[model samples]
Target: METISKIELRNLQIEDYLELRASMIEAYSGIEDAPWKEHEIKKLLSIFPQGQLVVLADEKVVGCALSLIIDDKDIDDNHTYEEITGNYTFSTHNPSGDIMYGIDVFIHPKYRGLRLGRRLYDKRKELAEQLNIKAIMFAGRIPNYSKYAEEISPKQYIEKVRMKELFDPVLAFQLSNDFHVKKIMKNYLEGDTHSLDYAVLMEWNNIYYDKSPKLINSEKSIVRLGLIQWQMRPLKNLDALFEQAEFFIDAVSGYGSDFALFPELFTAPLMADYNHLNEADAIRELAKYTEPIYQKFQEFAISYNINIITGSMPNIIDGNLYNCGFLCKRDGSSEMYTKIHITPNEVAHWGMKGGDVIKTFDTDCGKIGIIICYDVEFPELSRLMADEGMQILFVPFLTDTQNGYTRVKSCAQARAIENECYVAIAGCVGNLPRVNNMDIQYAQAAVLTPSDFAFPNNGIKAEATPNTEMTLLVDVNIDLLKELHEHGSVRILKDRRTDLYEIKKK
Candidate 1:
């Protein structure tokens, strides 16, 4: 029986070359090909450190997987092994390549039945995904085919192996690991006598590979935005409020909305329960709901597969009351953005203190930023976010009059054009007379865009009816913004005369 052993997988170090070579000799003895040299392993580590990995049992190297990245166009089934390895020079390794090309993988003969090779393959797949590489490709040998050399052709042997009539160790393992044969080549490795200089081209595509980088820099070209202009009304209970929020989330998710934005302090309706206390005390009490609501948003974000901008809610930190927003992503990950600007009414009535932190949040769809209500009126805030590559800006507000709503709406529109990005606004629009300091509301949820020929002339992608409770759905083309940044008639972002005047956080 194969004995169990504790093992550690890590990047191959140059010092372990002797032990790795010993393992290779035990596994590939009597081969007609050249084995990896100490210099070659050292070069691989120097060029692509993460690709060269080794597995150890009790700190002794037992297996290794060496790989390099290459351009997709460089992949060819009828190529020699040396061609891919840059004639053993590994000059073919491209830093910004699209494919993870496996140069060599082997496990010691004594550790054969331990499934260590599978661990190496799985790690390679993970690295491929992390680097956004398209696929993992390699040329695999048929070591067992030497026994039937005279009786069957290499293709015939492969067919029999696939049909379970024969078992070729390397070919069987590759197949079980979801690798598909791309082509069969002859003389792939002149030293591989067991394979008779024959090899099978195999590939495992990375399903998570964002060909254009779905995260980080390369964002989805088109994203559907949904804004829920919540109505300030009575709440039967907290569960009732969540169920209502879920209804909108499920509705928007059904429409394939990538994000759902709720109004600022949409949770304020719950403040009705604390009406007996002063406005300051009521808001502080509302802060206690932050944890549960934040957690619930995470749950709905995952279940509905939509990123959520949880508007803003009353929150307490270090015994100070503040308004905070949350970014709940579909992948069960989340981030927080505090309201950086405070209103006079908030300070006078609720004693709310503004947050000092400001930054952008990364989502699966794109990079975004949040500046609740009054913060949107500040041009410096959006400019800072734009400088950090924030492609979408969200503003969740609560206003009780047309004058206050206009202040947020007009400034939000200006932010979109000046930042060369998309701006989405949502706010409460109804009366919650029972909720103190939230007796009335006014809003016109809208998705604003930069003013360009590719966008709406008026800069409004879509807007809800004024002073109404509804949802505004809009699809913004991020590619247009990318183009506008370089080719638009008015290049606001690029034309900035930073040499003379600029905005910076102190």
Candidate 2:
């Protein structure tokens, strides 16, 4: 059965979030903190049901405008994004509030340039008039501000936009609707690279309203992790290898993925540059390129707007060589994780040592943990990560045979179920000729969730073809993990008997 395409406007239902999410992913590609999570939407609807609305096309969610009635006393004249909506928990929403505050609005990219946004705005205005609000206020994002950020100040750029000399998609439309800038606020929406995290506190005074107040930007953070099941091949120089990695990062960014996972020792293919030396010296020589490659991946993370897990690399610290990797976050911050359970071959061939820490790292969405290759086989590290509140565990591995790959895969799934968290494992496939101790690999990259009604019955959300060189993009809801921890059929986390035995940190 085929449905006819027709545009319709109505109040947003809780069920509309999934469709709205896909539309939102397309609308804000290469932008972080773009899509709103279901729980946040539920909070808004429960707090102020009439303020949330949606636009549907042929029964598909294509556009939406979310809002809440708030009091100005709870918000300040110089408010940051966090202070406005009570850190996106929407705690500031008050039923007897004196102002009409807009939290979010966007149209599907495919349906853009058709004034759909204008229609949504008109509906919001009607609702404001109907309720008799004081005015409509929004901390509207300046999306185009980043283009000329180096050449012009934010205030000057806003002036140019207001003067009609320069056009800003959000601000221009807002200006047409009689909204004027209260002021330009800094770091209004954190990690909004396009806006340099700057936004205008805009307001359109209501003439027909008798009473009702204040809102800034509100974006819900969820993670879509994209894993690169890499193919081991020869590259002549560092530039070629970096170019290849950036290609995958670009592809992942286009999908609006929050993080990109690369396989363990994916950089091992570069060891060919020093293949003339003995195995230990050669791998150590490969370590020389680690810093440069990490620096380049950091640029990719920021420029492409995706966090990058630089699969395992060789790190020589204080004369001790370690199997290590780095997490290059999109917000220009980074973290490092080393393999805590180095394989026997690594110790024999490259003198690799296990790293000490098993800590959780924070991302824009939530806390995450990283383990390399053999680390997953040891349950203690993962338990330590889980104890530290890690929601997603990233495992970057290199396996030489089907048996090796199975060990990592099975253990990863077990970790997900037992820890009550998501686990994403990636590895290199094919062969890297002429590079000692890195000659062959077999991989089946996948993201595994806990076995629960909300998750897959078998616990695998997405996986790539065995031994294939491809990208596996999967969207895992952080809320699902939260739900599993709180109300799943088997509460693995809650059921752990610490009194019997426990794994304590040294």
lDDT, candidate 1, 273-368, per-residue tens: 999999999888888888999988877775566789999998898989889989987655788989888999999999989999989988767789
Candidate 2 ranges beyond 4 A from true positions: 1-221
Query: Which residue pairs show collisions in model 1?
Result: 32-191, 33-191
Best by TM-score: 2
Task: Name the lDDT value of residue 305 in candidate 2.
Answer: 60
Q: Which candidate wins on lDDT?
A: 1
Scored by CA lDDT, what does every candidate get? 0.88, 0.85
lDDT of 2 by residue, 1-506 (tens): 11222456789889898998998898888887778899998888888888899987667898899898888676677788777788899888887776788988988877775456766787787677667677789899889988998999988998999899999999999997778889888878788888988899999876765432344213333579899999989988899999899899989877878899999889887888788999999888888999999888876775566789999889889988988899997655788988888777888888888988878898777889998879899988999989999989999999999999999999999999999989999999999778878889999999998998999989999999999999999988887788878888889888888899888798
**Model 1 stretches with alpha carbons more than 4 Å out:** 1-219
Q: TM-score, each model?
A: 0.60, 0.61
Query: Root-mean-square deviation of each candidate, in angstroms?
Result: 11.6, 16.0
Indicate the worst ten consecutive residues by lDDT in candidate 1.
1-10
- In candidate 2, position 234 carries an lDDT of 90
